[model samples]
Target: MYTFDSFKEVIASSNKTDWDKLKQVMTIIQTVQESKDQALYDYSETFDNVKLDTLEVMQTDLESAYHDIEDDLRAALELAYKNIWDYQQSIKISDGEASELYQKVHPLNRVGVYVPGGTAPLVSTVLMTAVLAKVAGVSEIVVTTPPQQNGVNQAILAACHIAKVDRVFQVGGAQAIAALAYGTETVPAVDKIAGPGNQYVALAKKMVYGDVGIDSIAGPSEIVIVADDTTRADFVAYDLLAQAEHDVLARTFLISESKEKIEEIQRKVNELAGEQPRAAIIKTSLRDHHYSVHTVDKAETIDCVNFIAGEHVSIQTKDASSYIDQINTAGALFIGDCSPEAIGDYIAGPSHVLPTGGTARFSSGLTVNDFLRTNSIIALKKESFKNMAPGGMRLALEESLQAHHDSLACRMEENK
Candidate 1:
């Protein structure tokens, strides 16, 4: 059912949409715009099945969360924090040394990070987003997530504590995005918003793009694995299943030159799917979204992989590193058999929040750079100004802007 003759066919067939669903999301965002805090409270009750007195997570609750978490989990969170912080620090923009014609990078005044919470707690997302903002020297980092009947997940709260988040609000979905885009009484409006969520959240971000900056409209998780006979079928199968379990919409692909290897991997996938805890989700994802392509050679496989432009790509060829240079359009590349996508998801020193739905062709994963804004420095000395005045005047005249030419002429007269 998932067979494809060429990469072009695969690209053409990647459409997944329902206009009615998007319209509903738009209506909800509009409602939030009208109602503000009341809309948030109503949505929390209607969708999340929780009645809340307040939208903000209290400071006492955050402290209790840190104390509530087990020692081992805290240690793991600390290690992840260190690795992510160190990696971000290493790549942070340094002060411009040039006297002119340079750019100065500075952190945003405030940012909002959305961590998804409902069935499961995404504590890692809290670290993946907030830690980068902290390392980028952001003055304020506000966190917003869906709350259970009791409150926000303790692990997420603990992560907030570790990342030194400035504020946490128990709100989610499109309403949460709307709240962040337009300030409510409880949640302060953010300069930019970052993090992943369901389709409604993605649409809300799309609607609010110009009002506030957004990271990306992330889709479901996806991975493409290019393997040869050397790669184990079981390993490939589990890798595909791992991504599939993320959501019923999540997709996984196996591209190989050997038909025999592809068959073996498919068989292993069926065998393992029955054993997974989230087997229903894995089954639906595999049935609807997963594909195994058989190419004539490694070159064709590589081209197909590039066309897919997956969020995560695992190359299990003889020399995995050899293919890295050719991989021009992937959110992240897992080089070898040992390098599972999980490593990058957890402690691989890169943010797991990546561009999805083939957006890797242009965009990239989340990083400290996303938290920064660059201002171009144009410091023209008197000599440089005089040298460029003639050209500036000529261009201004060519464009029929007398005022622009006069400004340059006046500056030249001052030099004279």
Candidate 2:
């Protein structure tokens, strides 16, 4: 299905625009304030087709959901919770003490987590955010999601219950974000918000970013597989499908030098495509964004992979571990065929929520660190301040800030 375009051609085509939907979504966000809660309700009916009564989910409903869920599914969710806890528990940093140095680690007082609700209930995402925040020792953790026609999804409620979230709110989209950011009559303001959602939610997060803290304004899901002759073509095809099924705008790519390998994977993609339930979405996503490169050499293939810097990078080359050492970007790197991108999305310890749209170049995936902020704490004994005053005054005067120099000099004089 991939064309034999040169490197530049592939890059150019990848940057091509289909901005009609993006523009419309932005307009919806811009017009949100005119209606407020009513606007969110309208979008729920239009986009999610679910009408609402009370906007917040209750504990009674959550307990009922936990009890209604099958024991097997509950067990699996519990296992995932344990795995995430074990991984994130290791991220603890001892609260730094202040002596002479001016750096300190401080935990945020409260944090809010948003879980996607429309199309599918993303119960696993609840685990991803809550576990990481809890590990960071955030004092108050709250969860927000849209209500379904009947009520909040049982699985999502169940996940919140297991995580022991301090509060659960029935809210979504810009209104939910605005509530968390500004604090309305019912919802409380939070220090940070983290999760994944459709474009409206993304734009809303971008809008409310400065008012409150956020993990990132995440983009659509992405996966880039670096494969060679050693990789099984079936595995490659399935890995691409795993990310592509996430959204219509999701991007998936394969970088390899072997023509036979590319052809085999393409055939497998077609065969597998026929059997998937989300075939229509996956097919459109593949046709629009998926491709295979016939790189000149292995080094060239690695260079090509780095340029993409996808949210998820799967290394299935002959020496995948060695290649992993060479690459410096990507939200998360899957070492071998057994570590599929899908596993990381659910049961794997690391966060499935990651930076996207080439942001892995600087930003990182969600972790306990995202929920906490570091403060710089500094203090000096009276004698130390007296000794350091002359140098500090000299620098302040050198910069022409006489007020700064005078303040230190005056303090030193008073001590003397």
The most accurate candidate by TM-score is 1
Q: Roughly what TM-score does model 1 have, to 2 decimal places?
A: 0.97
> Residue 389's C-alpha lDDT in candidate 2?
95
Which RMSD values do the candidates have, in order? Answer: 1.4, 2.6
Q: What TM-score does each of the candidates earn? A: 0.97, 0.91
lDDT of 1 at 158: 92
Q: Which stretches of candidate 2 lie above 4 Å from their native place?
A: 1-39, 414-416
Q: Give the per-residue lDDT digits (tens) of candidate 1, residues 1-416.
A: 23446546766867677688789888888888888899999999999999999999977888899989999999988899999999988988866877868889899999999999976578899999999999999999999999787778899999999899989999999889999999887889999999999888898898899999999999889999988888898889999989998889998888888888898899899999999999999999998888888887767777788888899999987878988998889999999988999878877779999998889999999999999999889999999999999999999999999999999999999999
Error of 2 at 160 (Å): 1.0
Best by lDDT: 1
